[model samples]
Target chain A: MSFELMLFDNFLIEKQAVSEVLLCNKITEDYSLALSEEQALELVETRSDSLKNYGRIEFGSGIIEKVILTFADTPYISQYRYAEFLNELVEIFYYFKNETLDLISDDDLIGTMKKYFDGVCQGSLDQLKFRELERMAKNVRLGLDPDYNDLYDSEKLREAEDDDE
Target chain B: MNSVKKTTKIDVDKLSGEFYFQSLLQEAYVKGVLSPKESERVQLECLKLLADCTERFTRGKSSSVRVEIAQGIMASNLYTIGIHLKSLPDVEAALFQIENESIEKLYEYGLQVLKRKIKVASYFYNRVCKTKLKTPNQAYNITIDQGFKPFFDHYEINFHAHEIPSDIDYQLIHPVTDLAGVEFVIKYLENLYYENLFCSYFDADIIDEVMTGYDPSYQNLLDNICEQVFLNALGCQLLNAPLHPLDFSLADLDALDRQLKKYSQAELQRQLKTAAQELITNLLLTNPSLKKYLIASLPKITTTIYRGLTTHSLNKVFVPRNNPNIKPIRHYNMGIKMDDAAYREMVTEFLSCRFFEDKLAIIKEQIKTLADMEDLLIAAELKAAEAAMIFDLLEDIELAVLTKRHPLHPAIDAIDYSASEVQMQQNLNAYMRALPRDRLAKILGMTTTIEVV
Candidate 1:
C-alpha cells in the first residue's frame, strides 16, 4: 500500500506491452505504416508517461496495441507522423477516459475515436481533441449518449432545408 | 564464553491495531527478523496482487483505472492481509506466515476471516437491536435503528473493506478506537449490546424517568444514557435499596454523600468497582462479557462520583426520578384558522399594499387566527424591523409554540426557503434576543413542555 513500494517501474509489464505494440506492425504494415522495436518501446514508455500524467494505472496488457491497430489504416495517419500521432492518441485516450468518468469502455472509446478521426476530424488531431472528444466526454458525463449532439441535429436540419431549396 | 540469554527485539504490545500489518513489517525489518530480500519479495507480491485486484475491479473490460482507485485497492488488500495476520497465535507466527506465504494466499486467509467477522457483526447487531434501550434520545434511537443499514447493504468487501460506511452518532461509554472498517464496527456494536443488555435489567419506564431526571431535555443530548443508568443502579446497590426503581431520594443522596466522602480517589474507585460487581450479581446478570463491560466502566463512574461529592452535587450524580408525563403550566391554543380562499385573497391584498403602514394596518384589521398570522409572516415581504411588529402581537406561550415549530436551523437557510421566510426568521430571532432575560428564559423553558393544539 505504500506508494514507494507500489509505484515501481514494473519492467516485465513494460516489456510485455512493448512486444504487443510490435505485434501490431503485422497488420499496420499493409497500410505502409510500421513501428520499429525502438519506436514500439518509446510508445510503451509514452503509455507509461501518459498514464502517470493522467493519474491512471494500467494492469495486464494495455490499450496501446489496440490503439495502434485501430488507427493504423486511417487515412489521417502515415509513417511520416505515425509515431507522434500514436503518442498523442495514447495520451488523449487516457485523458478522455477520465473525462468521461470511465462510463465508456476501452473498445467503444477507441472505436469512437477512430470513427471521429476518419470521419469528422479528417486528420486533424486538434479537432478530434478539442471539439469531438470534448463534446463526447461531456455527453457521457451528463448521462446522454456519447454521440448525442444537438448542434449536429440542427445542422442536419439546415442541410435538409438547403436540399429542399 | 558468556552464557547470557538474548531478549526479543520487537515488543508485541506496542503494535498498533489499525496498521498492524505495516507496523509488523517495519518492526520485523528493523529488528533483523525479516531480511531486505524477503521484504522486497513481499512488496513485489503485494503489487502483483494489486494488479490482479484492479483487473477484477474493472471486470477485465478496461485496462486502466484511476490512480486513487488503485491506491485504495492496495490499501484494502493490505488491510485484508493484516486481518489474517492478526488472527494468528502471536507475532512470531504472523511473521512466519508473512515470510512463507504468498501475499495472495495471505489475502485469501484475510477474506475468510472478514466473512466470519461479518457474521459476528450481524449477530451482535441483532442482539443490540433486541436489547435497545427505550429512550427519547434521537441520536440513540436513530443510530440503533438505521445507522448500520448501509453498511450491511453496501459494504464493498474487496475494494473498501477499510472504510466504515455506517452513520454511528451515538457515543459509547468506552469509545471503540484503534480499529478500522468492520473490526471497529463489530467492537462498537458489541459494547453497545452490552450496555443495552445492562440497561435492559431495569424497567424501561424507570430508565425513562431516570433520563428525565438527568435532563428534561435529555432527548437532544448526545450523552450515553446507559452510563448514567448504570451509575444510578450502582448507587441503588450502594444504599442497599431495591434496584428496580433506579432512583435515589434526597435522603439517599445525603447518606451516599456522607458514606462516599470518607474515601480517597483510589478508595472511591474500589468502592464503585465492588458496588458494580454486586449490582451485576444482584441483577442476576450471568453474561461474563456484560460483567466485564460494566466493571471496566467503574473508574470513570468513580471520577464522576468523586467530583460530585467534592463539589456538593451528589443530587446531580444520583438524581431522583421525575414523571416525564407532567403537563405544561400554560396551554396556549392557536385558535381556528381562516379558510384557504379568504386567506389567499387577504395575502394578495397585503402583498399589493405599497406602504409598511398599509401592510401593518391590513394585518391588524384582517389577521384573526395565529395560523393565518403564521402563514402571513412567511408569505409577506416585510423587512426585519417590520416583521418584529407582527411578532409583538403574540403572547409568550404563542411565541414558544412558534419557536419550537420553526427553530432557527442554519442548515435549512441554504436551501428550500423563500426570501420572506428568511426575513421572518431573522426578525423573530432578533426580537426574541431582545426580550427581557427572565421572560426569554421562561419562554424557552415552556418550549419543552408546551403542546400547541
Candidate 2:
C-alpha cells in the first residue's frame, strides 16, 4: 500500500482507540454521542489544516486525539458544538504552541483551560477564549510573570478602578 | 644479390627523444656499426649529460639555460671522437653537435617543450580549481580567479623554463607532472588564498614553502590546513567578526604584515598576549548570544542526543498503548527510518521546539522583568558547567518527544527550567566577588575602582 494510505489507516486506528477512551471516561457514554468513523476522519483533516499555519506537523503524532481528549470534559459544550469545539481547541492549541513558545506542556495547558472554563468563565467558551486565554497569551508575550491568577486579579482590579473613575 | 638483415627494430615515435637516442646506440652495437665497448662509453656520457640537466631543473634553473650549457660543453669537445658520430652509435654525438652548432635553435625547441608541459598542467589545474576546490567565502574581490591570475602571469613571463617535459627523464624536474598532483597543488593554493582573504592573516612564506616541498600529492597536509581554515571561519562567525571580503582590504593585510615585521620577537609575544585577553573581553560583551548559540550548536552535544534517539536500544516495559490514564510510557523498539537529511530536518524541528519551550517556561514561571532574564543569563555565564547541564536537560526533553512510541504527552505541560537556577545565582555572586576591583567597577558602571580603606 502507498505510504499516505498506510498513514491514513494508522490514523483511523488511533482515532478508534481515542473513541474508546472517550467512552470509558464517560465523556460520551453511548455510541450515538460518540464520534463516528467519518467524524473522526473529518476531525483529523481539520486538525491537520489548523496545524499548518503554525509549523510542519510530524505524522503519527495523534494530535487530533490529544485535542479531542483535552476538551472532551468542557461542561457547556453541547453535542451540537462538539465538532466545532474540537476544531477551535486544535487551532488554539497550535496557535499557543507557537505563542507560548512551546514551553507549556500540553497537559498543563489543558488543565489551565479547564480551570478558567469551570471557574471564572463559568462554561462560557467565548469568555474563556477572548478574556482569559488571550490575556494569558498576551502576558506571556509581554514577558510578564506567568502566574495567571495574579495577572487575572490585577486585570480585574484595573477594570474595577476604571469603573470607579 | 646479397641483402644485409636488420637486427633491431625501433619505433621512434614510441620513445622520448633521449630514449630514442639511447635505442639507436644499442641498435648500432647489434648492427656492428660500432663495437660494444664504444657504444657503452658513449651511452655513459649521454647519461651523465642528462643527469646534469635534471639537477639544474631541480634547482629551479630554466631548461633553456641547461640546454645552452649542454651546447657549450659540446662545443668545448668534452666528448671523445668516436662519440661524435651522427647516426646509430653516433646519434648521441649528433644530438650534442646540433646543440653546439645551433644553440639558439635548440633553446627555442626546449622552450616549446616546456611551454607545452605547462599548458597541460595549467589545463588540469584550472579544471580542478573550478570544479573540485571549494572556497566558501570566495567573493568578488578575493576570488580564486583574481588570486591565481598573478601565478599564471608569472609563468607566462618565465616561459623559458623547460623544467616540465613529456619525457620520463624530465618527470623529476617539476613538482607536479601528473593531473592528480596538479589538483592537490591547486587545492593547497586555493586554501591559502581563502585564509588570507577571510582571516586578514597570512604567513609570509607558508605557501612558498609548501610549493617548494615538491610533493603535489600531499593530501594529509592539505586536509589538515583546510580543517583549520574551516574552524577559523566558524570562530570568526560566532564572534561576529567581519567575514572575508566584507571586512577585508588589501591595505589592512599589508599594514598588519608591516607592523608584524617591526616588532621584535619578545615584543610580539607580549602584544599577542594582551590582544588575546582584550579579544576575549570584547567577544564576551559584544556577541554573547551568538557565542551561547554556537556553544549550544556544538556537534558533540547534538550528535550524542541524535545517536541516542535514533540508535540506542530501548529497554521496553509494556503498558496498554492507547489508554491515557494508565500512563503507558514504555520503551518501544519502533525506530524511525530516516536518512541524514531527514534526521537533520527533525533535529531542527526539535531544536525550534526546545528554544521556544525554554523561552516560554522562563516567561511563565521565572521571569518578572527583563533584568530577571539578564540576571539569569549572567548567572549562566558565571557558571558555565551548570549552564551546560541545563542546556543538556532542555535538549533531552525536546528530543524525548521524537523518542516516544506514543504522542500522548500534553502540548501544554509545565517544564522546569530552574534546575540550576539557584546554583547559577550562587556562582554568579561568587564570581562577582572574585572579579578584580577595577573590572567590577567597570561592570558596575563606575569609571574607576573605588578605594576601600
Candidate 3:
C-alpha cells in the first residue's frame, strides 16, 4: 500500500485581494485570514491560481514563511508533482546561486545541484505540525528552500492551501 | 546671411494647409514626437506649426512682416476654439477644420513676411534672445541660452550677435517661449486620469473630495492650455478671452472653459493622448498617428522624453501650492536691461537647476550608450566573437563613446538679414499694427491692482 505524498505542510497566503479565490479568508472585512469551508469552495470556484513553483510574487530580501505548493484536497500516493515543482525552483536557483562563469567542472555543478535538490525535500508535511522550521529558515535564503536558488524571498504571495484541520 | 538671401516671399495660402510649421519641422520631430533631437527641431516645428496654423493672419501675398494681422489672427482664432471646441469631435479634427476654414476665411490671402533690423521678441518661447551684438556663432550660443530661460521675464532683452546661420531662413525669430504650459497641462490631465482611474475602481466620493481639494490652478492650467492649444491650432490666441469658471473654482472663468475642465479627466486623457491625436483631434480627425499615440502602451515614452527637465524623479510628494512636480514654464525674464552680474546669475541658475542638468546628462549618456551599442553591432565580424564583444562591451565602463553627432547637436540656428529701409519699415509696420497694447495697458494698471488685491 502506498501513502500519499504531501508537497509542503503550509501554503501561506500573501495578499488579501488574491486570497479570496482560495477561500483563504471567510470573513469580509478589510482583511480576512481564515476561510470557512463554504467560503473556500466559493473561492476555489472564483479563482484559478495554481501553485506552480510556489510562484515568485514578491521579490528582494524579505519574506518570513516559505510557502509550498501542494495538492489542496486528498494527497495521492505515487505521483510526481514535487519533482515538477522542484524543476522550476531549481531553474530559479541556478540563475541566482550560479558561481562558475561557464567554467566549473560538471562534477562541481552536479554537487551544487544536489545540495539544493535535497534541501527541498520536506519529508512529509503531516509530521511537521509542531516542528519548528528554524533550521530550514536559517539555512534557506530568501524564502527559497535551501535546495532552490534565485531572486528575492516572496513578498506577498496570495496562494491558498489545504484544510488546516 | 545665406538663409535670408535664399528666403523668397511665398504665399501662406499656396502652402499646403495640411502641415503646420512644415518648413521648420524636420524629419526628426515628425515621427518620434519629442526626443533629444527636438532642441533644434522645435525651432523648425514652431515656425511650421505657427505658419500653418495662423495663415489667416497674413494680410498680403508677400510682405516682410505683419505684426498686427498676426496679433488679430492669434486673438480671433483663440476665441473660436476656446469657446467652440469639443462638439468638433477631437483636437486634431478641430485643428484641421480651423487650419483650413478659419484661417482661410479670416486671412484674405497669404504672404511670407520678413522683418529687417526690427526688434523681434519671441514671447511664446523662453526669455532666451541674445540680440544682435555679436557674431553668428556667439549669437547662436546666446540664443541657445535663451531656450533655457523662461519667457515670463520682467526684462525681455538679451542680445547675442548680428549674424545668423545658413540653415534657418528667418532673419531673426524671437525667443520662442518654452511652451511649458503645454507640458504642464498634459501632466494635469494625466494626474486627473490616474486619480479618476483609481477612484473608479475604489471609492467615488473620496476621489471627488480629493479632486475638490486640489489647487484651482490645476484646473485653470488644464483648461487654459487645452483651450490655448485648440485656439492656436485654429490659428488663434486667447490673450484676453474669458474662460468659464468651473465648480472647482469660485473665480469667474468662461463657461466654455468650465465644461472642458469638468469633463472626466481619465476619459479625456485617454482620448486626447496622441500628439497626433492632439493634432488630428484639433486639426485632422483621420490622422493615423492620432490612434497610434493615444493607444500606445503605458509609461508614455514621449512624456518621459521631454518631461519637465526640472523635478525630482522617484522621490515625489503631494502638495498643492508649491508642488515642484508641476512643469516649470518659461516665465522668468529679468527685464530689458541686464548688467554683467545679472546675466551671469541667469546662466548659473540654468546650469545648476536639476532639470537642465539632468537632461544634459541623460542626453550625453544616451549618446555614449548608443556608441557602445554601435561597436557591438559592428563586432558582428564573427557570431561568437560578436556575442563575446557584447558581453565585453557591457562590462567595460569607459568604453562608452559619446556619439557626438546626435540629430540635435547644433540645437539652435538662425539667419539674420541685412534689412533694407523698405524691409525695415514693413517690419515696423507689422509691429505697430499688432503691438500688444492690451498688455501695455494691463502692465500700467498692475501697480494699482497690487495694492487693491
> Which candidate wins on DockQ?
1
TM-score of the second chain, each candidate in turn, equals: 0.70, 0.23, 0.15
Compared with the true structure, what per-residue lDDT tens digits does model 1 show for residues B77-153? Answer: 98899999999978878988998899999999999999999999999999999888878899999998999998899
Compute the DockQ of candidate 3. 0.00
Model 3: lDDT equals 0.28
* Fnat value of model 2: 0.00
DockQ of each: 0.37, 0.00, 0.00
Task: Give candidate 2's TM-score.
Answer: 0.26
TM-score (chain B) of candidate 2: 0.23
Model number 2 iRMSD: 36.2
Global lDDT of each candidate: 0.88, 0.41, 0.28
User: Which docking band does candidate 2 fall into?
Assistant: incorrect
lDDT of each residue in B171-218, candidate 2, tens digit only? 110123222222223434433333333222323233222222222333
Best candidate per TM-score, number?
A: 1
lDDT of the structure predicted as candidate 1 = 0.88
TM-score of 3: 0.14
- Give, for candidate 1 chain B, the lowest lDDT window spanning 10 residues: B324-333
